[model samples]
Target chain A: MRSYKDIHNILLDRIKGGEWEPGALVPSEADLAREFGCTRVTVNRAMQALADSGLIERRRKAGTRVVQRMTRNAVFEIQLVRHEIEQRGGTYKYLLISRSEEKPPQKVRAEMGLSGDNALLHVISLHFADGAPYQLEDRWISLDTVTQARREPFDAISPNEWLLREIPYTNAEHVFRASRAEPMDAEFLNLGEGEPVFVIERTTWLSDAAVTHVRLVHPADSFRLVTRDQHGTAL
Target chain B: MRSYKDIHNILLDRIKGGEWEPGALVPSEADLAREFGCTRVTVNRAMQALADSGLIERRRKAGTRVVQRMTRNAVFEIQLVRHEIEQRGGTYKYLLISRSEEKPPQKVRAEMGLSGDNALLHVISLHFADGAPYQLEDRWISLDTVTQARREPFDAISPNEWLLREIPYTNAEHVFRASRAEPMDAEFLNLGEGEPVFVIERTTWLSDAAVTHVRLVHPADSFRLVTRDQHGTAL
Candidate 1:
């Protein structure tokens, strides 16, 4: 029986030595088992492990091959707003566009587990990094859960950063999608209405109580959204 | 004392009844305290809760104002491949492009935690759902881990679907980006180079060991990728 490491090394040698070149068919497991005098299961395990590691490709009956790509799998971390921009060597800026008191939107109410016409505090703003529009955040705050919100001027800071520090949200939900900007959105984002954008929507809770819901829009051409998982498991 | 539900209902009545309109500021906490005949903290709780629900907007020095929105968030769930094709009532087809055995490239090594020239099994494939061109999958597997890879044929079934059932992976990392497709990629995906494409790169790990890495390219105009989280938290 070949040691696990032995399987890894010998296979790697064949590939690197060009015995098995890119786009070339490989020998069958039966053949390898015959040549190495090992069990097919061991060969299967090694190959499965390799395929999992992104070293080679496997299919039902088509066989495995090499991948040539300009980009590999990249793990992305969700960033706090301030950190999101500073990492780019750009200054962060927040602008308060508008604010109001109104009934919660139906979807927001449903997501927050609120009954009909729940009063909500709504805030609209834009986030800029280095003088360029980075994100347009349109949000609704639950006046019922947060006390300090009444006295704050969002002009100097963002609700997200503030909530992270002062409020402890017990839960949250997030949604991501791609769409085009509208006419008003076009002007605000400095692009045409039909231009593509990346949109992220989030709802936070204070324990079982819903806290805040926000929709953030960013130019799709300019940025990418990233998330990482452990194979099938989320990171 | 007013029941929490009562507090929520009363506040909602005032907002929707136009007692507080969009862009119009809300009453002071002290005023609300007087009107509700509740303790300042109770009023605070209600207001805070409302803000959290996205029913209203809050600011530091600016107080609370009704929100005016230029955009509303839309959520889309990324669909599984099988569901995608069957939805169109088309028979899904799989084709093997190429397969080979070779040493892992330097970049692949860096990402996979391997040192020079590890043997690998590589495969490239085209997926057609409903008998039409759908996607192009480029993959790499480590020959060292799965020695049987030398013999597998991927013609009828996909490596992704196969691996999902046969091997359980512990971790995965994903990245989504927009890029212009090159000539070869365009030919495969049926798009011209410099045409925008939505690219997703994925890497999987089993426990601490790297298992597989894959790059899936989709024509941007062909379909949309979606993921959903219910709370403010990303799923």
Candidate 2:
């Protein structure tokens, strides 16, 4: 008596051996059961297992055929600057370069979905790992949504840390790109004027209200984002 | 007269207003119930909502306090080259540069966790969008695990597409970085020598057996990877 696992492995071998080409239909459960001297339920279980692994597709009456184009997903996590540095065995330091309440640039307002001439709290900060310039953070916090930000002094703690403790966002978007360092970014990150830099732009919202928008710039050679998936589960 | 949501917002305002600083314990449920003229259960529900959104921490005896460090998550999807190009409104094209079976380099072997003198199928290909070079794909398929790849000539279709349709991987790892293009990558990607390039390295396995490892390179100005999250759900 062959277990479903046995049938699964046997069918997997046959598929990998090219006995059935991609998009080609395989034997139905009833026929497979008869050939293997097993019940149709056992054969169905084996087929279902294969389908769940993305190897085959089963239609209502079209039977099972080898999948043609499989789409695999990869996930990357956005980490805090402090955590990223500490995880790399470096002492982390935060420096607040400037903080002011002003109307954000038109581009930023558009990105944050803010209409009207609303003033936001603008903050510029630098993060260091072992005394070396690591990340340049340009952040804007909405004073309308986070009213307490108006009275707070962000000199001691970074706005990122402050906001995380004070607000809970319901939506977030992240964009990762590579670009030549602008003058300000080059000056702060200690890089050549046109050196390549990796940039992450993030916008977060609390319900329908915008919370904050930030751009983190890092020296391209020193930073990378990694993520993994195991057993077909996204991480 | 306050509902859970009303209490939730009120508590949020007090926290944001710094009435209770981060790491500071707030009043207990009974106390908050008395203050808000609500049942303890209602207050508890409001507190639970705040905790669920990562705003506060509730301990058995330590009580609830504003959260100190909130770690957010971002997810990036690894898409097929053809699909990526098409999604950008360009005509996608694939060209096979070379294909051969050879012993992979030590670094690649280490990355794949292969410990023996194994010969793998190596493929070099270029992807074009709207008649311009878009990406360079350097891939190695373990002939030991993906035995059918040994006979498949990847001239008509990319090895990525062929393998996805033919095999199902149980695990995958992706690493994203920015690097200066090497000589071969420079030539294939049509970039100046040592120009910045965005790179993605991926390795996939079937169960515990390694199947393929690939490196994809693109011009820094042409490509980026974006991801999003909504309502606190990772996408």
Candidate 3:
């Protein structure tokens, strides 16, 4: 009996061999099963593996087709500030700079998918590694979804830590960019104004409800995100 | 019937409830199987789920334990620069700055795991979108492995596109960071010397043999990497 791995390799070879051109529809699972003399389930498994590897696209009604562009995913782990610092053998510290409930800026509101006139809990904080400023966090929490955050004081615990412990987010978006240090970042991260800084903006949601949107800034020379994959098929 | 998912949820609750403290060993698969009145295979599946979620660690002969740090992965798709520009509704252009076979810098050598005098094909190129400078690519191809590169003149096609079509790599690494533009970057990218830029360094290997190492620099204001996940369990 031909295993799924064998089918996967055979299909991969066909793709590499240009048997099906890019964007061209491949045979249906049922057709492929008959051609390979295997069960449909086995063919489906092989097709799913190809889809996951970014080589093919499968739609509900449309048949499976070769992807026009072969894109690969790079995975970066989102670590807690405390854990990141402690993992580097540095003592971690958190300090709250400011906290207020107000209508977030229009950009943030739109990014969080919030409507008009909704006040979110805005917070600014600094993370320290061994008494040196590390990251400056600017955050806006959706009080409508996380109602308990309104009553809790974030003096001891960061919103990041608290939210992770209290709420389970079903979706998240992360954006990475480079920008000049803002005044607040310059002061908190102890960097000269206009210096390059790495910024990570993240938004998390619990189902359809927005939970939090945060921007973490670090001095450019201090941090880098690295990921390694041992297998070609692994993301 | 106690499915793996049901067991997974119960174990997650136990971890959240502090039934097993961080770094504290949890019961082995055999023990948990007896308590839950299920087969060891079912319990093992649940434990694997927890481990994959960064909530637990499984060691050979040492049993399983709760993790001290909870980390989540953020996945960013690595798209071809040409595809990225085209996806944004711009005409993509490629310009070959220079190409030569020379001994790479010590840093490049170290990164590629090459010792002493290994002459590699160094290709510097610029990618443009709609007549605007987009990204500067500095690449080093291991001629030892990609021996055919020595005979090819990369005038009509970029090394990136050529290699992707020609070779298959089994392992890869990606690093993202920020940096001030060097003079070469400033001259090619039409940016100020001190301007901040987003940089991506990537290396690919065929099993243990290095294939290529590349650094891609983009103007800070023009590019940002974004990824969104709909499911909580996705990396």
Residue B117 in model 2: lDDT: 80
Q: Is the docking of candidate 3 incorrect, acceptable, medium or high quality?
A: acceptable
- Per-model interface RMSD values are 9.8, 3.6, 2.7
Cα lDDT tens digits, model 1, B165-210, are 3344445666666555667678888776656566666667655567
Error (Å) of candidate 3 at residue B199 is 0.6
Q: For model 1, report DockQ.
A: 0.12
Give Cα distance to truth, residue B63, candidate 1, Å. Answer: 39
The residue ranges of model 2 lying beyond 4 angstroms of the native Cα positions read A1-69, A232-235, B1-69, B232-235
Tell me which residue pairs clash in candidate 3: none
lDDT of 3 by residue, B1-235 (tens): 8997899888887775567777899999999899899999889878876775567889989878877655777677777888899998999999999999998999999888887597999999999989989999999999988998998788778898888767766568988999999999999999999799999999998767899999999999998999886431423
TM-score of 3: 0.80
lDDT of 2 by residue, A116-208 (tens): 898899999999999989999999999989999988888888887788766877678888887788999999999988788888899998878
lDDT by residue for model 1 over A1-235, one digit each (tens)? 6865578668765654456665556676667777788887768756655564454677768877743221122224445677878877889888889888888778888877887575788888888878888788888888888767877777788887776655654355665555567665577789777666667778877656778988887777777866664321111
For residues A140-232, could you state the per-residue lDDT of candidate 3 as single tens digits?
999988999998789999988888767666579989999999988898898999999999999998768899999999999988989886432
The superposed Cα distance between candidate 3 and the true structure at residue B45, in angstroms, equals: 11
- On TM-score, who's better, 2 or 3? 3
Give the chain B TM-score for each candidate.
0.62, 0.74, 0.79
Please identify model 1 stretches exceeding 4 Å from their true place.
A1-78, A87-90, A102-114, A227-235, B1-122, B126-135, B165-171, B178-198, B205-211, B218-235
Off by over 4 Å in 3: A1-47, A55-68, A230-235, B1-69, B232-235
